[model samples]
Target: MSPDSVLVRWLPVSAIAEADWPVLSALLPEDEQARAQRFHFRRDWESYTVAHALLRGTLTRLAAAAGHPVAPPDWRFSIGAHGKPEPILPEGVPPFRVNLSHTRGLAAVAVALDREVGVDVEWLDRTNLTIDLADRFFAPAECAQLVGLAPEAEKDALFAFWTLKEAYIKAVGMGLALPLGAFAYTLDPLSIAFDDRIQDDPDSWYFQRLRPTQGHVLGLALRHEAPERAMLDAAPAGLAALLRLAG
Candidate 1:
């Protein structure tokens, strides 16, 4: 795709089916197809399959839009020492980057080139947030903010903060290896900032709340060097549209 283009799409896992496998299959190189199949067996078959399909479909659409072949490119991806996925860029094709996340029934894919990006989403369940667990997983300041919230609003706000933090950590690609308790995120509903530990690399991270739904909250994270605008689309038809666009 053009260097300026940034694509983000969200797909519902429930909307995917066995019939859609062919579309996703067409996007994988022979090797990835095998690896993905194994990943399915090791995880929840339905969740893994659906997540893979959504990513494949989104990438296919992105490639098409860039006038590249709709099929998977020659690049290879391997997990970093810290468990972040990184592309083994191949020759000839334009540099391309992608990030994937799935939670509950929703899957999201973010694609661009020349910059690193990360995205994440989670289904919110207020009942799941316990003060003790929050203390263990959240920064002390975050816990204080959570405790100050009105009882009914606390769960939702806590979740929003959790999601934003997770999204930020994922964007950095260190996953849980990075200490969550070391950094504090602002309690603002739609925005978050890191504590002193991240101040040196402040521009490399950003977080934003996405459209919320019953039992769910979504978020996106990207390096400041990447495009500021992020496009989001819902499932089924959205996945199809993204594929067609890439094609």
Candidate 2:
């Protein structure tokens, strides 16, 4: 696939840690170093440590693709009014956006040359946790759809829908502060719609349910119109090669 095409990559959390941090660290700017230090990793290094490192590595490679310096600026990121991480963009570069999600040792990253994007993954456990949380987080119509599913199949489908919604919201950079209860998704798996309660412009948002994997469901969302064809690449060497120019 062309390097300019929209690409999605899934990196196992374990494999990310195995990557050389020094190689990764060389790509990070001083601001990134301070952000890494602020995290309290002693309690839950798996999420913050692994996710942060993977994000840095992925962004380093992405910046290279845009022909920008691999080193990011010393800009500090502050939460938006809606509580989403907004990195201070460096001057003279094309707009670049990324969103990260990890669940059960699997991490997914979505990168766009000049558009905002988000990706999310979830483990399909047999537990009733998703169903319980749906009541609080899901929209009324979504809950209705979940309740209508056959007892044996409801749990899996609910998670698939939930992940898609989450990715959509995060893609918009609003996070949970944006009311999820205000929007409803279709059962067809190809589209999502917002109700009157959602205050944002829905026209720019797009969502798709990815092929299911063993014990996992994946979803991706973006703010641009859907691409004619989407490509998935899993080669770490391809990513590493993109970053090697800065070395």
Candidate 3:
């Protein structure tokens, strides 16, 4: 597996403690430190810190394996005009793309070697959740399908549609610049129906639902086939080890 190839990884953010803060905080760059500090809530601050560290480490390893050998701090990231994070590459380097997402107690990152990719993970248990948002964001058929289900079944399918739609847009590298309503997804056989608004070929993409942990639904989008699903470990060299497993 080329380090730039597609892979999805998750790290548990629930267990990070005061004791681990020192080390985790040190891994972030100065701008990240400032950004992390802006979160007034402790939970938000901690999640941001850990998520940045995970992204930094994972991309560092990917760049090294691609023979570019840039240190984590030296890695430069810029936002695309449409809001996706784009890594600044050195001259003549092979392409490497990554996307990051987190919810409450967990964070996930998706990296692809030569192809663009996206990933999203959502916590399934929610107290104030409503299915009505589907009406605004989902395609007409998708919204109708979700609303027709019994309340229980409606919530079940909503999560799948939400994650898959998010993953698809992130892969498109346009973020929310592309409306969620522009595409529809099906669950039983598992597929997407993209509207004419999207000029890309439907068969050029691949999607997957991943379950590496309980209570989490992971959505993946790749320009290729199934990716190497990597697991985060407790060792200090966490993502590095997982990348080898993925390889």
> For this target, which candidate reaches the highest lDDT against the unseen true structure?
3
> TM-score for each prediction?
0.77, 0.74, 0.83
Candidate 1 residue-wise lDDT, 1-247, digit = tens: 4555545667665665667655655555667666666753433444554566666665555555656654453446778766666656544446767777777666776666665667777766435666777888888878878766787687766776677777777777778887788677775544454566665355445456665345567766666543355433333336565444324
Estimate the lDDT of model 3: 0.71
**Segments of candidate 2 deviating more than 4 angstroms:** 1-5, 16-43, 72-78, 126-128, 148-152, 200-203, 211-215, 225-247
> In order, how many clashes per candidate?
6, 0, 3
lDDT tens digits, residue span 161-204, model 3: 88888899988788898988888877876777878988866666
TM-score order of candidates, top first? 3, 1, 2
TM accuracy, model 3? 0.83
Go through the candidates in order and give each one's C-alpha lDDT.
0.62, 0.62, 0.71
Please, what are the lDDT tens digits per residue for candidate 2 over residues 1-247? Answer: 2434455666554444345444544445666556666757532334444454566566655656667654533333556565555455667555556676767656566766566677788877636557778898887777887877787578767877778888887877778877878777776746667777666555655566664356667788766554434444433323354245336
Give lDDT: candidate 1, residue 102: 72
What TM-score does structure 2 among the candidates reach? 0.74
